[model samples]
Target: MTHATELTVIHVPVSDPRVRPLLQELGDEYSRRYGKDAHGEISRYPDEEFTASHGGVLLLLLEHGEPVAGGAFRRYDATTAELKRIWTHSAHRRRGLARRVVTELEREATARGYRRIHLTTGPRQPEARGLYLATGYTPLFDTEADPETIGPLPFEKHLPATATHRATHRGKAAQP
Candidate 1:
């Protein structure tokens, strides 16, 4: 029999300097793995614009009080949110942390009245692309100008408004 560790999702404010080190680590790893430069360039935007204005939320996946994985979301519009900078430590891969983070972000967005969530993943990152597809995010048509210029494949998931209600109601209906 296998047991899963209890996962806690905490929102880390992006502006918090504590998060800078993690972001730097992730950026370094991402560049090393994909042969792309991301360290000092894209870091400023999230730390400034997205996190500043729209209440960007960074969901950290912690087990036993250690951050093993994390993801961020920024509101794009009333009906849309953008997922960004999702990363799981190499030691924590293949344990479904990425999937859980994405799901948690989607649920959070839905709770905030967003009906759609969007994200972009580079073509070189097959694992990310696979996860997004598996989670029902379809490829988008137009490409937005991003720092990488790596031609990220955009994905969007439109969630039903009633989905949350149904989820909350399942198996706990009034027994009167």
Candidate 2:
């Protein structure tokens, strides 16, 4: 009998080598689904936009030290984080990795004082839509309408203030 390997999350820069496969596959999937090269969309933002120094983050789920899933979030506003590139390796789907990635991104964003998260999944991606809804995101577009007509389907979740944010609000130093 085979045992399941443990999964671990790690923060990394978008330029990290392990991140390449996820990006490539994600671009390929997007292109295939949208019937156009997704290179531009995938590269729309500068890599620095997903780094900690820029008030953003990129993280990956590693299984046996190889990336199996990953996602990123960048500062969207004074109190919101914009989630991007949430992907689970094609072979690793239906195992809840995408949800795990979203949860991790939320935790990180909360730690950084973001009060909410905003994201948009492509219209062609019903799985992503289901994931967001099942995970408590409020759909910004009408659910009964045709998704293709809606273009990118937007969602948002208001995060509860973490202890750090509360401490900041209270004018006290937060414990590390």
Candidate 3:
């Protein structure tokens, strides 16, 4: 097992070559679970959507210079960052890597001036559902309903407003 100290986090554009392996494996995993090509979903958003200049970022956790886990978030609204493409390599599962990825994304989003986060995991992805829940995300849908009937399970987390965020909203009416 790799120790946490051995892992390194780096931000890169979604188009980086190192990102390809993660995407390919993630696409294959999604295809197997949903019985359809999910590569389209992977590419649904334009490449620029995950660039830093656009209020978005993609991060990968690498060990020994090889990508082991990764995730990304795009600007959902002025105050919300929408997480997408969170994945841990199949061989690297059960190691708490996804949680690390999520934590890192949240930190990055907060630094980028976002006060909330929105994300959806496919109904077929129970592990993802658990991960978000364990990480303090509230489900936006009824958890008791059958997952298949629910389709994509939406979850959200309101980040602790940074000093910048608090200052920006100091005298303004709180947005609902």
Largest lDDT belongs to which candidate? 3
Instruction: Give the whole-model CA lDDT for all candidates, comma-separated.
Output: 0.72, 0.89, 0.91
Candidate 3 wrongly placed segments (more than 4 Å): 172-176
> What are the C-alpha RMSDs, in order, of all predicted structures?
7.3, 3.2, 2.3
Query: What is the RMSD of candidate 2?
Result: 3.2
Q: In model 2, which runs have C-alpha deviations exceeding 4 angstroms?
A: 1-5, 170-176
**lDDT (tens digit, per residue) of candidate 2 on 1-176:** 11235888999998899999999999999999999999789999999989988889999999989899999998887778999999999988888888899999999988888888999999999999999999999999999999989999999999887865796666543221
Per-residue lDDT of candidate 3, residues 97-132 (tens digit): 999999999999887778899999999999999999
lDDT, candidate 3, at 144: 93
lDDT of 1 by residue, 1-176 (tens): 11245877788777655466568777887788678887865574645434524645777877787777888887676567888888887777898888888988887776766678888887667788889889998877443444255566889999666565556556542110
Clashes of 2: 0
RMSD of 3: 2.3
Global fold similarity of model 2 (TM-score): 0.93
Q: Count the backbone clashes (under 3 Å) in each candidate.
A: 0, 0, 0
